[model samples]
Target: MSGGVDSSVTAALLAEQDFDLSAVFMRNWDTKDELGADGKCEWEKDWHDVQQVCKLLDIPCRMVDLSREYWLRVFEPALRVWERGMTPNPDVDCNREIKFDALVQRLGESAQWIATGHYAHLQWDDATHRAMLCRSVDRHKDQSYFLAAVQEPQLRRFMFPISHMTKPQLRELAHARGLPTASREDSVGICFVGQKRRFEQFISEYIPPSPGKIVDEHGKVIGEHNGLWKFTIGESSRVSGLKTRFYVAKKDAERNEIVAVPGRDHPMLQCRAVNTIDWRWVWPDHDVQQVLALQTKLGGRFTTKIRHAMAEIECTPSQGTSPENVVLSFAHPDAGVAPGQTAALYLNEWCLGCGTITETTCTADLQESASSEPT
Candidate 1:
């Protein structure tokens, strides 16, 4: 249950329906002595809350330590991506690898279905005869982006109890039920790791900083960075010595440099296409080959999102340089498409699939924008 309002309410609502319910609080992170802002091991506090909720709801609650699985499956792969100077969306992998894959195996022969507090919807598609991922009724809080990599098999055996309610409404429901977590603040930061330590700080434990130069697009040095792993594509906070506000345009990993630009709409930050790997579709009937063919032949259109909480943008799918890779071509240049981020595809409200961005096609017509580049 994660000891959060959403999961607490999920258990409450399920209990209300009189379905046989048992709760499990998965302890995926095992960082000893790593405390959160509240000066306690985040998982320990969360386990206490889970126990309280289970007692209040009169249900069985169990704790499963999946620290090893999480590290091997989610953390290591993500760190490898970071080592490559690319930003990986570990949350997506967590959902796919840990939450669904490992958890399901752990629950073998015990439960027929699993439910979570994720803010996404699932509905049966009659045409496709499959359960499709849909946008939550609370559009602003939809989390289909994070859940995009979850396969159809895993998804079919899942339910999201609070998909129809907004965050405030969820809090109200919990409050009315006298749930202890009603007033608890929402958890933020990395999926498993707490926000008590900065992301760079947490990463530094493993990846020691290799200080490098920060340069503009033309190879002119502007500043210095502690490490390339500490910066993301389009990041501006870590950069300095620029006269006007500058956004991270790109990271030259080969040169061990962070490229900065004065304006937010710098050409390097904008791309006409993004190539992706590790593609997965939630719908069994859909495939990348068909999507590419449709886009290339019939000029089919779909909606896409590079990161969470952003409005979906219309895009066209096409074959990338390799068979395993698919490229998304946007009508206009898109900003902040970092390699290793997900390219979540959608059709209307249904989440189609997601792919890991590997490369991007910079805006070709940057002559005018480059002319005004910061000197």
Candidate 2:
């Protein structure tokens, strides 16, 4: 339990049931370990809330220090990606590596099943004899995308207590039950970074400044950047001397340059396809093969989302440059598509799996023309 209202309500619901109930709060980050850091994560307050909830629920509770595991398994790998000037989702990694994998190992044979407040559903598939991950009833609060990287074995042992309810309904239930966290605001953004610290400032402590050039579409240097990590694809560049606004079109890691274009809707910002690395599928091998076969016979059959809360967009999956990779061809051009972002796949409401984007095919014709022009 993250000491949040959702988890607190989850504990309350389970306590009313006949099963053996226990609450475990995971400490994934240690603020003291962050050398020369300004703001700290309110993990202590969260742990206090968790303790209070467990006391009210009358369940055995314990704190599991998984900070070392998280730093090695999730944060280090993410830092590598960031240093390469690509975006990485640490939350997704935390769900797969720390919560499901490491935490389950810690529990060993003591616990039969693991339950959480994740807004996703799990169903048994008799045909495949495996557990299938599904979307929650609350489409707006659905979090299946973050669990896409989790293996099927992990999904089998997982349960989502709040899968059937919406956010407001869950809060109402918590309030009626007199839960202490009923009115507590939901946590947002990255946990380690907290609510106050700027992302650039937090990341700068780890990644040394590698100043680079910000260039326009025609390869003209427009402004200077402190580091590639400071900018994100498709966001306004905020280049001061420019008469008009500029949006980040691309990040050239090899050149150490950020390419910015004149308007928000610039053609350069739109990507028609993306290639993924380290592709993983939650379905069985046979099931995945069948889907690929169907895709070959038909057109795009799967819908995909590159980030949470984004509407699912139709896409066609095919073999990428390598065996481990999968390339998704979007039905329509999508702006702000960037490398290192996970592309979660779904067949209607069932989340199939996801992959980290390694490359994007932005309006190819326009890119060729732009490159052909004189600098």
Candidate 3:
């Protein structure tokens, strides 16, 4: 359960309903491993805390090692995009690689459905024999965007216990239930790759950081940047020799230089097409067909998100050449969308699966996927 309040409360709620549960913590990231020869680390502290929480709950807990799978499926892909100067979303990749893809395969003869602490909903239709991914009731904590790439069929066996629970209610219940993880703070930063500095350093070991040029919108030289991976579209920060603080407006992988704008005149970031949407399982027309046809029932005005926790901007989806390559046009303008961010398409409150953001009418990428819509 990761020894967090939300997960602790989730276990409590499920237990109260008389559901037999055996919780498993995925050891996807070994923070100590990331630390290398740097001696013991704080991540070990987190690991100890997770074990203690499992003990207090009196539930059987085991660690599932997904290190290799994660490396192959998520980290490598994310690294590829980042080196290419795209701001890829790792959270979305973790969902697909660990939650839906690996966990489902690992369940084997034991578990029926995979459960996580994510605030999202899963629905099944026996009549239509279909499964749907939906947004959580709590808008603030909704994680539908992170799960936009979830295939429709695999969702049939998925369960989200926190779908309707608010963050406050979950915390309060955790303490009342005397769950050991109740007091644990929400997790922040990278779980496997470590912190920003750590991940960047690790990446540099292999990718070989190349000093690049910083330029303005008109292709005028502005300053010098440390590395291409260090900057993302719409990111505001220091650039040596720049008179004013700048935001990354564009990145040219070919020249290994970033184009920055003095202010927020970043009208050049938007693009066309959201290619390669996928789900947990196949539904008819899932290939490249849904790109164009959303059955009349699925079509309409929906909020399409380029990243998580940001306000959902309005969009309308239409049939495309490929089901995976559907096109969505924004109803209003939104800004700062990076090339590798996942643009999740949602209907009402339901997460109708999602795809990697190959190219954007506005701009962005799928979570953590390079070939498949990563997010």
Leading candidate by TM-score: 2
Q: State the lDDT of candidate 1 residue by residue for 1-375, as single tens digits.
A: 999999999999999996889999999985663333344577888999999999999999999988889989999999988988998988889999989999999999799889999999999967666888989988887899999998898898899999999999998999999999999998776865576678877888888778889887778887888888888777673555557887787887888888888786877778778889878888655776676554565444688999896777888776666555778888777777788899998767878888999888877445656778899
The models' CA-based lDDT, in order, is 0.84, 0.87, 0.69
After superposition, candidate 2 runs with Cα above 4 Å error: 36-41, 284-288, 293-301, 365-375
Q: Decide which is better by lDDT, 2 or 3.
A: 2
lDDT leaderboard ranking? 2, 1, 3
Assess candidate 1 and give its TM-score to the true structure: 0.91
Write candidate 2's Cα lDDT for 1-375 as tens digits.
999998998898888998888889999997766564466458888999999988888899999999999999999999999999999999999998999999999999898988999999998877667888989999999999999999787888888999999999999999999898999998888878877788888898899999899999899999999888889998999799788999998899999999999987788888888889888888646244667775666554689999896878898877766656888899998888889999988876778888999888888555797799998
CA lDDT for candidate 2? 0.87
Better of 2 and 3 by TM-score: 2
Ordered from best to worst TM-score, the candidate numbers read 2, 1, 3
Q: Write the per-residue lDDT of candidate 3 for residues 114-211, one digit (tens) a residue.
A: 66788888777657767777778888888878776666656667778998888888888878877777777776655665544566766676677688
Higher-ranked by lDDT: 1 or 3? 1
